[model samples]
Structures are given as structure tokens and as C-alpha cells.
Target: MDKKATVQKSGMILPRDLSERSWERIGSSLRELTNSSAWWLADWLIFGEATYGWRRYREAIERTGLDYQTLRNYAWVARRFEHHRRRDSLSFAHHAEVTRLSPPEQDYWLRKAEQQKWSRNELRKAVRASLAEQTRELSPSQSNGDEKQEVTQLSESAGADKRRKVARLTIELSPGQLDYYSKVAAAHGLSVDKWVTQVLDAAERRTA
Candidate 1:
């Protein structure tokens, strides 16, 4: 970006001969912003709803440029997970995966995802598998039918799983750094890799 681009409010302009390094950095920041936007919008909607009642929906739609249903869905997920219960290691989509589950169940799966570093689709599969087991254990009756329907809805809510390409990131660490990360990860019952990723994610969100 040029110096003029930094001060420009209308849009960001790239330099004619921008370095690949600079473009990569820009893309990385954009990805972080996209990921953090879910939590940020959800939290904002929750606060607005609490303070302004039903009228908040209209205000939110106008201010955020997000549809009413999307805003509503965000609020529902945010309401399901209290601030303390959210998994910093996981994306907001990960929490949405277990929104219909009981609080303890949500915590259980989130902890597993954090420890295993599962992607959103992986977490969805694990949750559906468990729910299927429960359905299988039940007798064929109205209640069992209802449970099956609920499971279907949960599956549908995740939308299409296009299975986008994933890029693996590797970081080198000193022995002392490894030990420190391990201890902190253990304190939070997460793997060292997960802990490191979570810390990095939090830092990104703070700046975003």
C-alpha cells in the first residue's frame, strides 16, 4: 500500500508493484478479520438485544448489513455459550456445532475439539455420531422420532461441507519455549499446539 492508501478512507489501494510478502500479509490479516467477525458480531448483537429489546433487530440489520436471520442465529449461539464457556482454540463455527447440546455436553465436545484441534466439520461429525448412537439406543416411538428430527436439523444447520483445502503451518520453538507452552496448555487441559494457536488467535482478535 502507498502512504496515500493508509490515509484513504474510501478504500485501500495496493501499490502497483506490491511485494508478494506484503500481499500475503494482507491476506493473512483479512482471514483473521473474517474469522473474528463472527464472534464480534454475535457479541454485539447479544448486547444490543439485551439493551434495546426487539427494536435492536432493526438497528442491527441497518448498522451491520447482515440479514435478520443471520443476526438471529448469531445471537442464539452467543446465548448458548456464556463468555467463560467459549473455546478460544476453536472458531465460532465450532461452538455453533454444539449449540443444541446441553451445557455440559457443549463443554465436553468443545474441550475435545480444543485438545484434538479438530476442524469445524470434524467436530460436527463427532457430534452427529454421538447423537446417532443415542438415536439407535432408543425404541421406535414418537419421542425417538423427534430426537432423530432434531439430529437432522443440527446436521442441516451446519450447511454444506465443501471441505476446503487446509494449509498446515509449522513453527519452530526452543526447548524452554516448548516446556512453557506445554505447562500452560496443560493448565488449560489443551495440547501445546492448540494452546499456541489459541494464544495467537486471541492476539489477532485483539488487534482486529
Candidate 2:
């Protein structure tokens, strides 16, 4: 029990005249705790819900004094990522931003975020931009559900082996048309080929 600094479940308490070294240590400790608290709460909720069924939410809210919906959202993000899949470099908020993503995408964006040192808000913006690009690639007539599935299918189609039937089509494009498609595809982080497939698939769906 150092009189210079104290870290507790309620919050950190520090002396007014702490040494620079003590202050630095307390700051480091606080950072670790701040980063970890979400995962800890999430795992706690998951275990409690599994063990207590529906009673867990009631007891957790009363004991923790946390908002019920926030707690539920935290647990949902936790359940989306397994312990092994969780990234040490990113915070729970980063994971929360990617919860709407597909399984493969969850890993993709997390790795990008960790490597690029993106903040939670930055990740959220990037995810939103990506979704918007996909929606734009899909026509306005399609629902967000269709756009989400299109993105997931694109990711899977990239690495997957095509075992089913295939038909090849060759379309002649003007130079201007080719350049336009390339720019559109590059903006959306897609290849011109994939962009064409996405456009064609969306058109087929609209007609169907």
C-alpha cells in the first residue's frame, strides 16, 4: 500500500505532491487499467450470463451501476471476438467499431488498426467510409443488408476457389470508361475486376 499512489476499482487516488517517478508510474498503471477494464467487464458479463441466464443482467446492473444497454453492447462485442482473436494493441472500443463487420473483416480491420495505430473514432470513420463505398457500388435500390453481404462475399471470393460453374464475359470499354472504373474501384479499395463483378451482381439483383 504505497501512500504515494492508489489504484482501486472505484478509481485512482493519488497524492497532490507525488514525485515525478511516482506520477509516471501511476499514469502507466492507469493506462493499463483503462485499456483492460472493458475486456474485464465484458468477460465478466459473458460468464455471468452463461452461468445465471437472464438474471445476470439484473444483478450486474444493480452491482456495477452501469447502463444496461451499454453493458449488453459490450458483451455483444466480446462474444464476437474470442480470447485468441482479440488484439492486444487495440482497445475494446476498436473491436466494438468492427462488430458490424464480417468475421474475416473483423480480423482485417483490427490488424490494420493495430499496425496503423488508429484511434477508435478513426476506425469508426474508416468503417463508415468503407460501408458507404460498398453501398454506392451497389445501387440505391439495394438494402444495407444486401450491401453488407456483397462486401462479405467480395472478401470471401477473393481467396476462395471457385468450384461451381463459371461463365466468362468480355466487354469492350472506351478509354474514358476504363479510367472511370479504375478510379471508382481504387477509391473503394477494390480492383477493377472485382468492381465489375460487384456492379454486375447488383444489377442482376435489381432486375430479379
Candidate 3:
């Protein structure tokens, strides 16, 4: 090894490797990357060198007749470093908060929270194990809002022979419309009626 050749670690830059021309290019690349909110330059620098090192190791192994598995392991390590670096850039926790739920449920929570602007505490409360106790008796559709749902229970028609009557309304939907409804409903795990209500509610809120 040349005494002047600096040891490069995975995902890091060494001052000794900078030629005047390379230093100027790096400075230019950094400025462009920073302006575009591409903050993974540090990660790229580290991974890029690791990849070069892996190629060198493989060549040396072949020349010296060393174990193929050892070189393979080195390649795997380099790939893993790249994977972790990209994932870390996404700012996700090591263990997701809602890991027990289905993937769609997890996506729903993430998107819904972002759309509704929920605070961390509010998000935790909304998805708490005992959510029913804290939440109002509304369908999943109605619970889409960030605000607390209001309950307006009326006294059972006091002394007027308390009776509850149910009303049913039916409408015909075209095959294409029905398909669209099913697709939307399946995405949210809601009934078609619930999905329609949610769409209308969101529209109303946006207009308001």
C-alpha cells in the first residue's frame, strides 16, 4: 500500500484522496446537490468508495485463489450499507409504530396523519389500543377528520312512546361506477356508502 493513500471508510470522504481537479468537482457537486435538497451526498461518497473497494477485493481474491464466499460476503456487506443509508435518509424509526397492522393500514395512517396535520400526541391517541373509549361512535369514514367528533344524542322522545324507525334508500349505479366505488372502498377498507360519505365530507371541508 502506498503510504500517501489514505484509508477510506464506507460512506466517508478522506482529505488525502482530493486532487485539485477532483476537489473542485466535489465542491460543485455538493452545491448542486444541496440546492436540490439532495442531502445523501455523504451516503453516496461512502457507498461509492465501498463499491470500488469490493471490486478490488474480488480481483485480489481471484488472483490469490482465495475463497469465493469471502469475497461474496464483502459484496453483501457493501450492499447492506447502501440499503441502510437510503432507509436512514427516509427518517423512519428502527421499528415502525404500527407494525401490527396490515401494510395498507400502515400506509393509511401515515398519509392520513400528513393530510390532517395531526400532532404526535393526537396521532398516538387516535391509534391507541383503547381508541373506542376516547373516540366517538362514528364510522371509520366520519373519523377521518382531525377534529374530535361531536356526539349529539337526543333524549328518547320523552313520554312519547319511544320508538326507533330505520329508513332505507336505494340507487342504481352503473357497472363502471360500481367498480370505481369498490376500488376506492377496498383501498380504505370502507363500504361504498362510507367511502362516498368520506369523499363528500372531504370536498365540503375543502370548500369551507
Best by lDDT: 2
The order of the candidates by TM-score, greatest first, is: 2, 1, 3
Q: lDDT of each structure?
A: 0.68, 0.71, 0.46
| Model 1 TM-score, 2 decimals | 0.55
- The TM-score values for the models, in the order shown, are 0.55, 0.61, 0.26
At residue 172, give the lDDT of candidate 2: 52
Q: Model 3 over residues 1-208: C-alpha lDDT tens digits?
A: 2123233555444466457776676667655554333223333334545676867745655777756664344434334333423222222221134445434444455455566666546556656733464244333322224433322221212244666543333435554555565566648755355566666568877998
Instruction: Count the clashes in each prediction.
Output: 0, 0, 2
Error of 2 at 81 (Å): 0.7
Of candidate 3, the 10-residue stretch with the lowest lDDT total is: 149-158
Better of 1 and 3 by TM-score: 1
Q: What is the C-alpha RMSD of each candidate to the true structure, in Å?
A: 18.3, 12.2, 14.6
Tell me the lDDT of model 2 at 113.
86
